[model samples]
Target: MSTLLPISAKTPAGRPRGDGAETAQGLTPAQMARRMAGLEGLVWLDSSRPGEGALSMLTALPCEVLAGRMDTDWQRVEEELEAGQKAGLAGGLFGWAGFDGRFVLGVFPHALVYDHDRRCWFDSGGLAARIPAVAAAAAGSVPRLDFSPQVRREDFLSQVRRAQELIAAGDIYQVNLAHSWQAAWPRGADALSAYQRLRRVSPAPHAAFLDLAGVTVLSASPELFLKMSGREIMTRPIKGTRPRFPGDPARDAASLSALLASEKERAELLMITDLERNDLGRVCEYGSVRVDGLWEVESFAQVFHLVSTVGGLLRPEVSHAAAFRACFPGGSITGAPKKRAMEIIQELEAAPRGLYTGAVGYFGFDGESRWSIAIRTAVREGERVTFHAGSGIVADSVPELEWEETLHKAAGLLAAWSLPR
Candidate 1:
């Protein structure tokens, strides 16, 4: 059995003097995660890329569990968050919201926070003493994962063609289409080990690993969906992708130049940027919303992406629920003219996207929050592990190329699963 320790308000022993922060001596975030693996409600919002604000956060033994199924749940979650703030919990609330508005949230009283800026770990409670012993335990080898796509290639290409038809007919300008892959859970491999492998291969700015009661989430997403600090709100959306070629510098540079010069890619990013601006405008102070960054290329392990940043100052009267409701499913994943695109997607796709393209992050008791666009993510439930990849389809998109783009976007995840392209 794993140890569950409550956070001590007073600094515990073994902590360094003069601020109670301890430099990481024995356990890496992965090791700490392994120490608490299988603990219900364990949430790790891991910044696998260091020097990006918070290094990582580990919390388990939730004091309050919040869940909802319908759209109305947003209001309930907001209310619960406000109440949690009033109750003065030691730590924050963390969880994910699905694409369909279904969500599972948790408020933890104990936590282990690692601050990259400080180069130290803040132990909210007493779990540190129990972590180092388990750090040295060797992880089990990951076995081959025989993943099968839920959508056939021919069917996906046909769906892409249909979406192009819709664009041509003026039903929608752009739509994001996705398909899932599933594999039987290997008997000896655990979620922690898989996540460790994933982070090693695809270190991302917004990576995370979550172990809920019966569900496990492993994410290496590089897109930021929403961030709220005080009355300020911001979002970064990614729209274009080009695979990286590390062995060939000239090819890699050519890929970067090509991505920057593609009009189609620029158009795709612009549409989503506009959509995000509109969403923020709904709850933001008038004239405060602005595009902070546009058409910037961010390179990741497997690919390079065109990213844009939009932000605004929130209206004084806007509540957290209202802010979230205005922009629940991010525009980048939903496409331009959000509602209509989502309708088209629902009509075309085979299965519900339970967590893919959703938001995964935390709402702090301090009234701050950060969420990532849930791409490059996998979910483990019972004996099955499932994941999905998506691409934005436009009028000029070729069905074959769009299908290949999804595979490119899924390269890191596929590699983590130890599968070939």
Candidate 2:
């Protein structure tokens, strides 16, 4: 594992020093992100929703790129982050960690951080100076995408049945099964424009647009995987889901009620919640881990999810990497007995998940970090675009209904590309 040499002097905790002329100039984060499109190493951590204490961040021109495809590589990244923090380096590391240990992270010297609550942009690097020129440039059109499922309906159903069989044999209590879609990246469409369209239809609190060396990630994930502020850490896992009825209030309310009342839904969420608690216990101080919230319903533009919050204070000797290793690839996305569930997922799914169900976020040099579970996310590479949606298959899971649920979860991504469900 390579280490980051100390860069600039440290600023205050949680607050990076800006150029003192911070202003939005009446532009939204989305607009600013559009201006920054096509820039390599661009990372925009967007909070599409308002007033959640979440800040949108944009930064480019990485001083060092930290990328890896194995667990050892991830450990190196964690070590680099911890070393940077101890050395009092200014700035942060931003990028995504793919399912398993594959990741592409970068260390930036400055950034443009937007405070949603205050409705303004703070320029840490002098990079904010170019925003005016880019904003004045013409925004390009988004091309239409024709996406087709990589997994046939019959195959998906069979996979679900296999998962159920495993549960029957006590191999696992639950497993998350997924299918993917692929589309040719059209001539004129760009990652940022597609992300803009996606946010328009399905804005989320943990959304992001990350343009790396060879890959671009457009995510509108609603699940928080991990958050670290000093010694305190938290994880919010989403397990159960119900699609929303956009035009019919009565139908939507009924759907929400049914999700809340379903025994299967409740059981699914409880299993993951317990799994998260156990995961946290590994890195947190003894007796400090606890469930902050359980079996709560959170409504998004396209679906209603049963979410739970588990948190604890980290052990004094625990490093950020240690904390993440204890809880990577969140339990909500995998299932109970995570290792076995992932093994079954690999055996049954059509292809590797790549960035889907992975995590996207940042690790500040100040020891603060935040990451979101990469569901409802798309990855664009060269002329190809790929995304996946999944459902938790419990013992009583019906293959047909589970397939339907995957479609419901995929509705937002498809709608973003102007494709019919």
Q: State which candidate has the highest lDDT.
A: 2
For residues 45-106, what per-residue lDDT tens digits would candidate 2 score against the true structure? 88886556778878877888988875667777777787778886656789998896788889
Candidates' TM-scores? 0.91, 0.92
Query: What lDDT is reached at residue 77 by model 2?
Result: 77
Q: Write the per-residue lDDT of candidate 1 for residues 223-277, one digit (tens) a residue.
A: 9999888789999999998889989999999999999999999999999999999
In angstroms, the error of model 2 at 329 is 1.0
| CA RMSD of each candidate after superposition | 4.0, 4.3
Steric clash pairs (candidate 1): 7-125
**Residue 71: error of model 2 in Å?**
1.5
Residue 171 lDDT in candidate 1: 91
Best by TM-score: 2
- Model 1 alpha-carbon miss at residue 399, Å: 1.4
